[model samples]
Target chain A: MSSDVAVQIDRVGKRYGRHWALRDCTLSLPAGRIIALVGANGAGKTTLLHLAIGLMPPTEGSVSLLGTPLKPGRPQTLSQVGFVAQDHPLYRGFTVAEMLRYCRKTNTRFDQAGAEGRLRDLGIPLNRRTGRLSGGQQAQVALTLALAKQPRLLVLDEPVASLDPLARREFMKTLIAAVAETDVTVLLSSHVVTELERICDHMVLLRGGRVRLAGDIDDLLAGHRVLTGPRVDDAALDGLVTATHGERNSHLLVRQPATAPTHPRWEAHPVNLEELVLAYLEGQD
Target chain B: MLWVTWRQHRAALLTGLFLLAAVTVPTLVSGFAMHEEYRAAGIAACLTDPEARAGCAQLLDQFTAHYGQWGNRMIWVTFLPALIGAFVGAPLLAREFENGTWRFAFTQGVSRTRWLLTQLTVVGAAAAVLALACSVLFTWWRGPLDAMSSPMRTAAFTVSPGLVALTLFALALGLFAGVLLRRTVIAMGLTLAVYLTVRITLEETLRPHYLSPLVRTDAQKAADALPPTAWVVDEGLITTAGNRLSDGDERKILQQVYDGDTVREGGAALERYLAEHGLRHYTEYHPADRYPIMLIIEIGLYLGLAFALFAAAAYLVRRRTS
Candidate 1:
């Protein structure tokens, strides 16, 4: 683990009765970096998120946050880790202003002015109850609360799932700005890799409860490329490693050091965030 | 903190107050039929006028109509205060976790335990007050009816104050349940079942001590008409405490004193005697001596049960998860 890493998991695993939610997962998230965790449905993304949020304990292995062992029933881990849950599970009855006050009263760290400013910036009523707001607005309110906390690490679980594309981008802008202002570490999970690719500096691709890939986005994308063309002999790509292959063209996406491939029989194109994620997941199965 | 709960829960709290107000419907209208019915049953039978008898019967009908459904109403209304508590108090923690707003508190440099406790403090305080207000209203609604007939109120006792306890009970339980369960629906269900089941059982079954302490019945009154010596042969037990212990029952004369023990249960009723030279032995005792003492005993028993359950609930709350 890096000296400045905010969170570290050592072979963590979780289970529900006979079924396993997560198995043998390992990763380290350093401070002041935005990491996007991508996965498919029922892919243990939430189980890992729960661990990061300190809402649950791992059945196997240990998860450390801020250099302390993660524990439940106490919120000590919360000071460093801010969690923004999916769907913004807010009190339906409390107006935005009341919600803000609730936030301030229950949490000494709440910045009233910052929360108010965020609400104002979003054009949401401080007096409007969350239940009465549009889905996008509710998401914004949740994001506002997460931002106002100014935490050391902000953990967002599908935080923008309920927002429209425009609102999502707008919310992400506000979120990025808030994290920038506070220098809070960001670890967000999403199925939409492209959206995360826009603001996130690093990425963790999760498949079958393991870290398929984890590193800086630039380093990861630069090292991998989709090699699609007419069928080429494996001997022709002797220096490259195939990451994924599609049967239709026997297409090979390869990851190699930044070296020029002069073979004309194959096409080498840098993979986009979506293509990288798809290739990773496709390779996992 | 409480203000925030009130701010969010005002509507539900008001609704509860209104429901408590509605509970007075029986007592408020009871007077219309109660006065004459009390006359017909307790004083004299005034069946001469058909309209008057019908009115009295109608009054009696109200009490009997709800006898079977009484227990069920208590269950349905269990959510009355719980709604205020669970929907209001539960969101205290789960909402933070759900919306990610909890980060705001953590970022403020507050320790997580202090923050959770603070929310519990603020929200729990608000819920306790609202629940108490609802309880008081319901208690008052039953007050006049309680004054009307002690027995009916005995059955009525099974509801109002018990419901009040369940209200506070539900709020605290809901807080813990929602935390442990995480999902709102499951938490609400678990809380309602745990709190009200205990409330209902305590009121109707376990604490009531339903089997008669003495087994006295109208048939026993007829059996009391037998001679004291014949009563001794038929009755297995008797009580002569009034003859010895009560000052009023002592009249400086001994009618009969051939008992092995001081007295036995059933035989005591047969020990009655007409005064010889105006002498009295346990014949003129008034039960008023037991009234004030019994009232305190009854209230103590019920409230004691309530207190114990509530304390257990509070202790369990600190263990609540989310």
Candidate 2:
């Protein structure tokens, strides 16, 4: 693994009773890139993010963050990582200022002013109880708390899954600004694929507790093409990830490096990001 | 970490203090009044000297008539520990897990073990201080009543150092319940149920057996009367053959002596009958001086259970996931 790699997992698997939430997951994420972890409802995206932040320990194998072994309940390992859990959980009874002070006290290098300034910029009251704030404001506070840690890596598990479209846009704006301001590597998990392609440079597609496809977005799209040609039951397409037969023609999403089709009767077209992800997911089924 | 713990729980701490004040103020007022009434009625000399007690029965009766209602109200203190356990201790962890905030807390620079310990220590200490204050205040307030009866009386016992241990145990039980149940109201309910069960079981069954009651038997009637303020556990009529006289034997003897008059109609006939039959009364009593020893044993038992529960809570926090 290179020094710029943010997270490394080697043969990691997590089991709950008899079911495997994640199994034999091996992936290395590069630093300073916004990575999207896209998967279906039960596709182990949250489990992988949890393992990276040491929220839960894998039943087998190892996980490392920024080249250091990640062990759950270790202060040193946790100090380098910041996480925003689903629903952006915060103490509902505490004032926003109290929440910020809480972060400052428990973290060694928390930027208290930075967090307060961020909340103030968003017009969130410092003395108001967090429960009274709008959901968007609460999410902003949660994100500010994570950013205040000055972490090397930030892991978010569907932070905007509960937000309105406007709130989602605002949250994404703040996140992109945070990335630009700091040299932090981000791994964001979401089942909503419509909004992610704009901000994410790298993608890891998961299905049923396994990684189906992972690479730079540009490279992944460049390698896959949809070929529409005459239907033939016996015909075989090279580098076929998935194929579908229509009434008069067959559609093939192939993973070949060539940009054009070799047959004269076929048409080749570039694949969009969502089509690419849906193809891989459906193909796996 | 300290600030974070306090910030997160300061409202609860303040609420506890408010409750402490609410209970303590009235107790102090009523206590001073009771003491003045006792001294003015000249009941102190009777309580201090057994001989003067004969002449001061009226005075003691007056004091009891005036203040007995307040004494009965003190029984409410038995539920104070339960309140602390349910509201303060149960929510310590259950609320975090229920609100999904443990993920936020556990990811801080401090480890989960340290975080739990710090919160437990700070909150436990606060509870201890409140418990200690209430214990001392009520003990001082109930001094006159303690003089009237043995300190082993249930009302007086409710305010002893034993109560402090009981509170700690409740707190630990609440924490353990919170971890196991992971819901505030449910854990609170479980804490109350478990604490009451243990307290009632120990008091009813295990307490009297802390030490064997002193037994006295003699053919004379004078030996049957137990010591002043001693707790009478049991009494029975023993025949010369060393067998207990059942109710049938007593009735037959009473019939032979009273000549068709029931024993209740004439108390002297039953006494005369027992004496003539060479039967003696065996009395089992725990003397009042055993108060301190019983206090130690009871407090030790409660503290022991509290520590075990605290260890269980800590273990669960370390091993279980959110």
Candidate 3:
């Protein structure tokens, strides 16, 4: 309920007929931070993002955006949260300027001049139909539209999944530049871990429709340690996350305070974001 | 929201306008020529003068033979509503889902319900206006033929004010099918099939029963027993025992009476035989005055169905997430 919490999802669940795509998912995404939602395909990342943005109602629990209850089709909640669905869907027949105009007409607080300027700076022609734009240009246009809404929270679902690496870098550069200029909180989902590590300060890893690990990247790294020592059973260590062993030695990833005492024979090293996320994801199965 | 709806559907709307003009220009030119011929031929005087019925019958027959097939060909215009439903209504929502722009549209500052309502209003109003225009044009086009027979018949009725309601119903059906199926092409196909079925059922099976026919029995078959504008529902022989002869029995009796003869004298002999057999000729008809009541009833039926379909489409839009 704090003003610092941009989105608070409590015990939310989404069901598709007999299957539950997301269940018992609870998270409080802090305002003004770039949060990465890391998950593989069909891991309920899209479902959770949709529920948070009020694109669809949660079947079981509640979602609160900017301290108010999330209601699908409620103008107040919808205006406060901007969303870019997967593939950055756009009207193919509309010119880029017309797409901008359409966004302006549909939203209450659209930054028309700012969006036009952004496109102009990017060398994207205003009169070109969106269908004719390159994949990267289309992504940039979709992002521009979402940002120009001046939303309090921005949600993107697998935004760069289909873009080539160079385009992906450019898309991230535009996104980061916009974030620097606004107080908007961002929550973007992706399966690729390394790309997110550079931009995201906070992280949530999902596995099999459940949150596997969530926290500040620095805090998660500080808490989890990778220990290597002579072959030993993992049962002795407290807060064990995952363990792998060879004939001569064993390695364990454990969650514990950074200053915690360790075994005299073992050497402990700080866990990186990718290693921490992958350890928990692999630990699940 | 209005601008959004217009921008998204302007192509379909313009296509509808182009089609309307395509049909209207020819109809307007031909309609003027037909009206000129009707006046020049003095068909109006024959309709009013009772003694003139003899000469008028021949003039009327000539007028009808010349333009009757033209009026009947206008029945193809009945497909206008179905086409509107298929191209305009079906693609209205189906394309959104098909192209996945619904996600972009619904997540904006406007609510989903408002967005949908705006679309329905703009598109529905455009369709209704086009249908009204068609009704006006065709009603005027078929005016000469209507005087020769009855406008209460299928070909004439399809172009009446009832067309407005039927068009709205078709559009609503398309909208509902689009939301249900989520595929534009499939929804269009479904809309055509369903629209034709409902239209045919109402026109062929249910139209006559809107009001009970007026029945008259005569010992002699009087040619002028029914009015000129009366819609003849059924005509047959009735026995003194109150039994109506089936069409097959009447055909067999007519064959026996005529005996392959093709002379006016054979009609007198057929009448004499019917009188001797205690059989009377019966005519069942709907008078011209019933046209207004029939129009009102048919319009009410289609509007009611349209209302139901629009409600169903709205409900699905609210309930379905993807």
Q: Give the TM-score of candidate 1.
A: 0.66
Estimate, for each residue in A220-262, the C-alpha lDDT of model 1 and write its tens digit.
Answer: 8888877777654553464344434445454666776456554
After the best TM-score superposition of candidate 2, give how far the Cα of residue B298 lies from its true spot, in angstroms. 1.1
Number of backbone clashes in candidate 3: 0
Higher-scoring candidate on lDDT, 1 or 2: 2
Worst 10 residues of 2 chain B by lDDT: B220-229
Residues B45-67 of candidate 3: C-alpha lDDT, one tens digit per residue: 88888889887777788888888
Q: Could you give candidate 2's per-residue lDDT for residues B77-152 as a string of tens digits? A: 8888998899888989899899999899999899989999998899889988988898898899888877776677
Model 1 stretches astray by more than 4 angstroms: A1-3, A228-249, A260-269, B18-153, B159-212, B215-220, B223-322
Model 3: fraction of native contacts: 0.88
Among the numbered candidates, top DockQ falls to: 2
DockQ-based CAPRI category assigned to the predicted complex of candidate 3 = medium
Sort every candidate by DockQ, greatest first.
2, 3, 1
Local error of candidate 2 at residue A253 (angstroms): 1.9
What lDDT score goes with residue B241 in model 1?
30
| Fnat, 2 decimals, each candidate | 0.23, 0.89, 0.88
* Predicted chain B of candidate 1, TM-score versus the true chain B: 0.50
Return the clash pairs for model 3, or none: none
